[model samples]
Target: MTVIENIVGRVTVLRGGRYSVEVDVITSSGFGRFAAPVDENPDLYIAEAHRAVSEVDEIIGPELIGFDATEQELIDSYLWEIDGTEDFSHIGANTALAVSVATAKAAASEKNLPLYTYLGGTFTTELPVPILEFASDSEFDYYVMVRDLMEITDVVDAVNGVLSNLKEATVEGYSEATEKASSELGLDVALGLAQKAPMDMEKLLTLVEDNNVAYLKPMGDEELFLELIAGTHGVFIDGEYLFRQKDILDRRYYNALSIKPINLGTLTDLYNLINDAKSERIVPILAEARFESSDEALAHMAVGFRCPAVVLRKDSIAKLNELIRIAEDLGERGRVITFEG
Candidate 1:
């Protein structure tokens, strides 16, 4: 048996070409803290589990042995089959969660950041504590995890379920399927924004009354505000409001603001417009840029570069940083600096 199993704790290869993996602490101290029964021979249990998995592997591994592990859905099919077998739900769930988490960790490692950083939010502080609520599930394409606390009771289970479901959904183009479910359930869904700085709990509740807002974001400082706007997609700026658009929003790409100067499109006019927007604390998202010496001209061109002139509400620093990051990432030729109050 040319077993190529690597050591990552419970990752193991047993005879009959079976593989079993577990993500659990095998230490006595961990068992002591739990009220559950502790196995004196955890190794033996692990071994038996692997043997069982190997037997099942003989039946399924051939179909998948040389397949991609990074393609989790493909890997999950066999696991799902194992789950359907007699007395395998707990093991299957545990195995799947561990494997899924490992895959996520690996991806994050490739990006050289923590998993939450990969999700969003800067690694400037500790991870925000997520709020947990236990209600009958409804139809929201996305659920925003709110609160700044490290942990809240009651929500742990739901969060895991949502995360797991989200991963699977992402792998499968879950939007189409969810849309079908929403139609069948007759759920009236809408998308909107929530202001959540210093945790605006009441405002969030109020915004949700309409249920039209899909994304509720806290308006941070200048930098953060800009970042948030950069993050939003599918809505283009129209005058002062974000008008809905049919195109999918790409969080990665930059959108430009359009400038109008009495039908004269000159470099001087462009610079002035871009500068004016910046002077007013509006970080203009520019498209179609070329090098220009004057900061004034560069700034003006930035403003009138695109639709709706998406600007952050002043004093949102985190948002300002985010916006600056977006511009910088898109190779805008200006260095971001804070204005003194």
Candidate 2:
């Protein structure tokens, strides 16, 4: 007999004669192949996972442990606990995912049928699974660094080196820029300079200064928290100024970014989507979502998203010159603006 751990101890039956249980376990090993071996390790990840499950268990687990797992309302209540909160990293996301799978399995078991039957009676054996080929200059790792980067020079040198290397790796199969001059001439370049590691502002300053680059400013922590709730979009490659747009939903692949004042409707929608995404544990590195404001007046509010961070500016471009000016003026009190918005 399997001696289930105390956390997974009991199940409760609710409506439709279904049952569910809240389970928490300290796994003997970390989950991710990429993140497990980092020098920092998965200490934070595991700790956060444990914390998240524990929080879910403390609330909904006790209430529904002995109740029918198929109680849709009960399940919903469990989901609602973290619905609007952006802090899904440590909540019951993994557990919720497992439970969703379990619910399907249990329903299948009771019906003496396969899991997909609930979706539709027909079962198509094969689905188109995505094959993401991220070719890189070096084998990229997601281990987050705890180091502080403060100088503009360091930022520029590091960003330039990283971008150059990545460009060499990924520029081979690009079909879009095959006719462009530098690209047509076969000069390797980072596609969009998208980075997956920790971003240090000091490093960003350096990159902006060295390259003479202009960029959207990052919303500070306070503004971020607020816009996260209101669902405004805000993000920055190397902060030189703030960017605002009407709506995040309008943002799609390669859509030319427009500088404009974001209105209330778009801001609210952005907030809801981001919160929902966070709750579902679907943090997309290359997507934008809305956030809310933390204060009454949202003058500091903004929008956010992800981009492939290539330094797309050439030395002679006017945009490049503006970026240089801003980078040189770092630490000085002056308003930064770009694109008339």
Candidate 3:
């Protein structure tokens, strides 16, 4: 009975004056709205937001008006048919993807299930490790945040660790904290970093390898991706990488991939990406979408069940407690919260 009644799409200017589509899917029970993540590449942008909205208004809306939003495959199939491209070209991947996510949300709300509970299901209790991120230096009880930790390390580590002990501890200290916390919990925790931007990938990898750090979310283009892959670093493939060269996904050259739903365009796509990551022995680290609202963050935690870890950026600081609550509600624990002020 909870079918889609109608879908309305709009164009909004996002941060930095980029445009994206925001789509609202109204179902018999409730409505869900999603704003597309900003596209970084202009040359291959998914159709302008206005044009995407126009297609949604004139064509996609009519076909989906009475469709069952919960029938994800059916609805997404229609969306793909409308676009007729793997990346959503004809009808705008951003718009189509937003509708896809909105539809999933609406359906979940209709069932009165928290989005994470729905995506992760009722009986699944275990959750991924939370990789706490801090934009500044801060201190908190490791016992309060650290819990059971797990890791998969190869033979490469010659040294170890994280921040200059400012936003985070020195990379060596970070690893020690995780090690200490793991000892307390009797769990095996590995340190991860989102700090490859300013560092030399080769040198940084050596640093992390020597120090015993586990992974690096060094986001970059094809060349960087290939470099990370060749170095056998646990690469964190993200939205920008996905948008630019998803073909890289065809080859499982890395050991980990961190993705956000917004970059993926739909709940289904996000789900599939996790599956892909898993199949390739790549640990999926669900990262926050670009400036996503709180609900989207919840959705990430919901699917966090499917990943080994989830990375929360600085924007998630205020909502971290709420996110932890949701994870606990699902019987999932192990939260490492790092933050800055």
Candidate 4:
């Protein structure tokens, strides 16, 4: 029956001394554990983790005991009811997400199915193309260096050389870097800008045109988003600037949406948002938060949901390695996802 028997949560320390919550969901037939990361003030992250643990021990665990772990949607909805907040403020979003995902993992284990197969059925084989970031001396020179090195040697050595010799350059330089990398690497590579502050419209447009920028995460107003969309040929306006306002997707201002589990509260909520984004013809990108845990469940979710792309940090090796394994397991059935801007 896979009836829930007990639930436990504990504080887990992550890289750079960050704190997160690891949840263990025990059922009649199987068990699952998941660590959902929380990005907070370093001074208060420990307290937040403790609070999430306390919520599981004192509130969520007791309420969810005896429920069927396989009924993922019902259990996830109950998490929201228990929190009694639109934003999961009472129990914390990290706690809700950890419990929701852990329950799914337990059910999948009981059925002896891989997590992606359990969540997405047997036909889920497409893998999202990874957008890797590097800390280089210049924004675009690494692209040129990597391309040239790949021509002389292999990709690994090229990346290694770039990492060993770090330098900085202005974004305005290397206007043709994206085209060169795409041609040389035999894969489409585009520039992604994480715009934190407003810039002059003319200047932003010039940068996009000069650099062949394809993805933009703009922090400006709706006018700026509209300007970029109209001004560029095929630029993808990322919806991450909207943050928690998933409802704003209805406006169709952005061509791509970022899905982060912790921000959305529960697995069902995350799933629903992905579907919603797709309904609007928006490219759904499973993204990593600024401060992430070591959990690889996100990689599974990206595969399960058939996200076209994933915005992952270069140093997030756990997720990267998992994606590699999933690709190998799928063998001939797996292919990298392709989509237009």
Q: Which candidate number has the best TM-score?
A: 4
TM-score of each: 0.24, 0.32, 0.69, 0.88
Assess candidate 1 and give its TM-score to the true structure.
0.24
- Candidate 4 lDDT (Cα, whole model)? 0.74
Q: Candidate 4 — worst ten consecutive residues by lDDT sum?
A: 144-153
**Per-residue lDDT of 1-341 in model 1, one digit per residue for the tens?**
11112213244432223334433211111110000111122333556556434533343334434434334444455555655654234344324433333433343444455333433334222211111211112222233222211122212333333343343433122323323334443332222232323433343344343233333334333333344455444332211112112222222222222232211122233345555554554433332111111112112222223212222212223323443444444343322221111
- List ranges where model 3 is wrong by over 4 Å: 12-18, 39-47, 132-191, 194-202, 218-252, 297-305, 318-321, 331-341
lDDT of 4 by residue, 94-187 (tens): 8898999999999999999878878889999887766555433422212222212211122333334334433434454333444454565564
In terms of TM-score, which candidate is stronger, 1 or 4?
4
Sort the candidates on TM-score, descending order: 4, 3, 2, 1
Error at 126, model 3, angstroms: 3.0
Report, for all candidates in order, the number of backbone clashes: 50, 47, 13, 3
Q: Output the lDDT of residue 235, model 1.
A: 30
Deviation (Å) of 136 in candidate 4: 8.8
Q: Which sections of candidate 2 miss by over 4 Å?
A: 1-45, 56-58, 71-74, 82-92, 120-126, 137-168, 173-247, 251-341
C-alpha local distance difference test of each model: 0.31, 0.28, 0.58, 0.74
lDDT of 3: 0.58
TM-score of 2: 0.32
The better candidate by TM-score, 2 or 3, is 3
Top candidate (lDDT): 4
Q: By lDDT, rank the candidates, best first.
A: 4, 3, 1, 2
RMSD of each: 22.5, 18.9, 7.7, 4.0
lDDT of 3 by residue, 38-114 (tens): 54444323356678788878888888988887788788878878777877756766677778878877887898886
